[model samples]
Target: MIDQILEEIRRYETIIIHRHVRPDPDALGSQGGLASLIRDNFPGKRVYIVGEETEDLRFLVRMDEIADSAYAGALVIVCDTANQERVSDSRYSCGARIIKIDHHPLVDSYGEPQWVETSASSTSEMITSIYRNHPELVLTGQAARLLFAGIVGDTGRFQFSNVTEETFLSAAELMKKPFDRQKFFDTLYQRKLAVVRLNGYVLQHFTLTDEGVGFIKLPLDLIHSFHLQSSDASTLVNCFSTTEGLKAWVLFSEEEGLIRARIRSKGPEINQLAARYHGGGHPLASGATVYSWDEADGLIADLKVLCSRT
Candidate 1:
């Protein structure tokens, strides 16, 4: 797979990298890392990283805006995205050849050459694997650092169950490059007082059902009170994890006319439940969006039942 991907890179003179919408660290990292890798090794190739930025991840890398004509003969490399609808740019389809590199479960196979490694901790890890196998492709310090950030971010600092021995090996390889690991952590975790207070509110108002399903529902007013976007508050679902006597937890924040949910579980396949609510992701970490509070409650009820069964 690495050989084939490398061959595709050699064939294209112009390369455009993309990831999922509302880019996460893994998404941005893999996109940026691959772009850097390609540029470092193949200096003649024109590389561009295109994506919609997230406030939390803007510090990592800058996104590029290219003319639509640039994609006419370009090679598009998409990372960390499961489905085409979630792709950040619609121009990806304009490329002469499309390469889909992802760690998500196969949702839709949009690219001619698709590499999906669901067992990999993150898409960044998979990219690191490619670098490991193909030493001919120069891996710069900046690219390694970006890949390291992606691996750490997706694995929850190696706390998530997805972290395998290969994850650590890949991380160790990236760490070989001289970068400030402490500084990266500091930037990744830096939060404002408002976010701290918001977390306190979430913990204080969190609900626990009889079936051990912990949940917090943040209404539009509460979200506005914190001066936070729904996606910002949804990230607080991590606070519900590691608590005693809780099988699964979800954070629901009002987004526009819908309620966006971020779901986490100590154990159990909750992505199936999220699928019913118009969203799906990894087994333990998944998301959903519902039209009404009643629908959110119904989804919560289903989760409670799932917990009881487990």
Candidate 2:
């Protein structure tokens, strides 16, 4: 499938990389690695990346250089994205031809050639597979670092249950490169003192519905009180959901005059509940936007029904 994807890549003179909205390390990493791969192998071709703004993910390098004009006659390779609606750029639909390389299941197939690997740990792992079979292709340091970071971040330093033998092999390949492992971990784990304290504040407000659904709410005012960035407020939605015994967790924070929610589940398809309020994502993790805290509370009540059903 990768070789076929590569064959398709060589057909286009211009390429644009894309990923899901509110980009994570995996999404940005795959975009970076793939762009580097193409630019290295096809020197005459033009490659660009597109998606939502994730300044933190710029650690991967060159991910910030994409221009929207690249959409013309471009083969857009979308990474780490599941649902089409959740993709960062609607302009992707306007691409001459689209190719999707993702580790998430298909919600819809917009591309002529789509690669979705449900069992893969991350999209970066798939990109590693691409480079593995063809090592003749140059592995730029920027690309290598992006792939490494995605593998580590999505695997939670290989601590998550999703870490498979394949994940280890992909990681082992990356470790062969000369990179500072300690500094990488520090970059990911280290948080501002205020950001660290805010986690404590969110944890303090946590409540579990009778059905074993855990939730934390951070009002917009509270976000203001802490002088937290919207990204910081948005980042805490999944921390509690990933706990050992919890069936589900919800993080509700206000941003730009709307309540943005991040929901996660261990044993249930909480996305159905998220869809009820005009938002969606993977079954285990999803999001919704609501007008007020009251609406968010109603969504929470609906989510409890899902938890109870599970």
Candidate 1 lDDT score at position 104: 84
lDDT scores for all predictions? Answer: 0.90, 0.79
TM-score of each: 0.98, 0.90
Worst 10 residues of 2 by lDDT: 57-66
Off by over 4 Å in 2: 62-69, 241-245
Model 2, 1-310: lDDT tens per residue?
A: 9889989998889888888888878888888878887887789998887766656555455444555676778777788887788778787777798888887656677786888887888999999999888888777766777898889878768876568999999888877776777777777777778787898887777887678778777876787788886678766776665555578888888787888888877778877777787787667767888888899889888878878887
lDDT of 2 at 29: 82
Local distance difference test, candidate 2: 0.79
Candidate 1: deviation at residue 21, Å?
0.7
lDDT of 1 by residue, 175-251 (tens): 98878888889998888778888999988889988888999999989988988778888568899677788999999
Q: Pick the candidate with the highest TM-score.
A: 1
